[model samples]
Target: MITKDVRNWLGALTFLISLCLSGCQSGNAPASSPIETNRSLAPQRVDIRGSILSSQYSDGQVILEVERLSPSPDSRYDRAYVLVLPTAQMVDSEGLSVSISELRPGQNVAILLRAGGQGNRTGIGVARKLWIEDRF
Candidate 1:
């Protein structure tokens, strides 16, 4: 007969398995080739310095025009125009304050981006963090 402890353990194990399987389903089509399936999950850090081309706080994203920056190996994104997302830990360049309204268009500043979201159907480079320079 199964003990109470054994039954609880099986329930927990099933929950964990389900959680892992959910991550596998990204709702995108399967990779066409094996090479396409293998993508580095290493998070990349990119620093961009330029003027803000546009800012959309309502949409929770920002677009900046790069004036001077290094090229990224990921060909899925355009280095000239970058999309910035506001994370919960998002802060200013000083790293003391967290304010999304401080960002405005036509302001010259530097942005630090932590790259993510590749090979999951959305190959766009998503920023995991942002460090906005003091300009608003």
Candidate 2:
């Protein structure tokens, strides 16, 4: 009972639906949603460690002033400003649970930064991983 024009429209709709379903089935690609357009793509990870010269926490985010205890021969920052998020894990000298709020100035710590963009005026890098060394 379908006319020729109606059949063609149905065929096109079916093709589009199939394409969408295939994409969904893959399950790897993110679905269409609002994306942050201003932020740059994630960058390569890096590692830095030093004594805590200063620590600032607000709105569940942290910026630490770390004086590199020992820098690589080519290190650009004898003291670097490192960014840490609330999601970053924290541990104590004995490898037990610690809170970011306990971190104070003059504590020796090590930080691992992942997906941090290159520095400009903001600071050195953003930290994806952070650990507090035993200040004892």
Candidate 3:
């Protein structure tokens, strides 16, 4: 025959143990785990230093001949990349805002692009930012 006080204490201890077990089995990874740092879950951004091959402001597009300056060189980046510039922020060497029409062929440039996806093998990407590295 257990006393009332002992029963209450056992019940409370059982509740706490169950609570702790439930918390440990919640199935969430720790903050610093590799799962939490998976790159695929984040937006992929590519940066390239290249020369402008051509531009069509009316069509809001620019063709860049990649020089493969960042993220290590890869054969995939050896070709020209067609960058869509409709919403891109372009700046000149002086850091002043500019337009696609102001860009010229043969001008050195640094571009930040958002990777379209794995199925996009045509080298077409959306330009997030473009910096004209040469002064006209």
What tens digits encode model 1's per-residue C-alpha lDDT throughout 2-66?
79889999999999999888877865557563322322122233444445666555586665554
Say which candidate scores most in TM-score: 2
Better of 1 and 2 by lDDT: 2
List runs of model 3 lying over 4 Å from the truth: 1-46, 60-76, 116-122
Model 3 worst lDDT run, 10 consecutive residues: 35-44
Better of 1 and 2 by TM-score: 2
Query: On a 0 to 1 TM-score scale, where does candidate 3 land against the true structure?
Result: 0.48
Q: Which model is ahead, 1 or 3, in terms of TM-score?
A: 3
Candidate 2 residue-wise lDDT, 13-35, digit = tens:
99999999998888876665332
Greater lDDT among 2 and 3 belongs to: 2
RMSD of 3: 9.8
For all candidates in order, the CA lDDT equals: 0.51, 0.65, 0.58
Looking at model 1, the pairs that clash are none
Give the worst 10-residue stretch by lDDT in candidate 2.
35-44
Q: For model 3, what is the error of residue 36's alpha carbon versus the real structure, in angstroms, after optimal superposition? A: 38
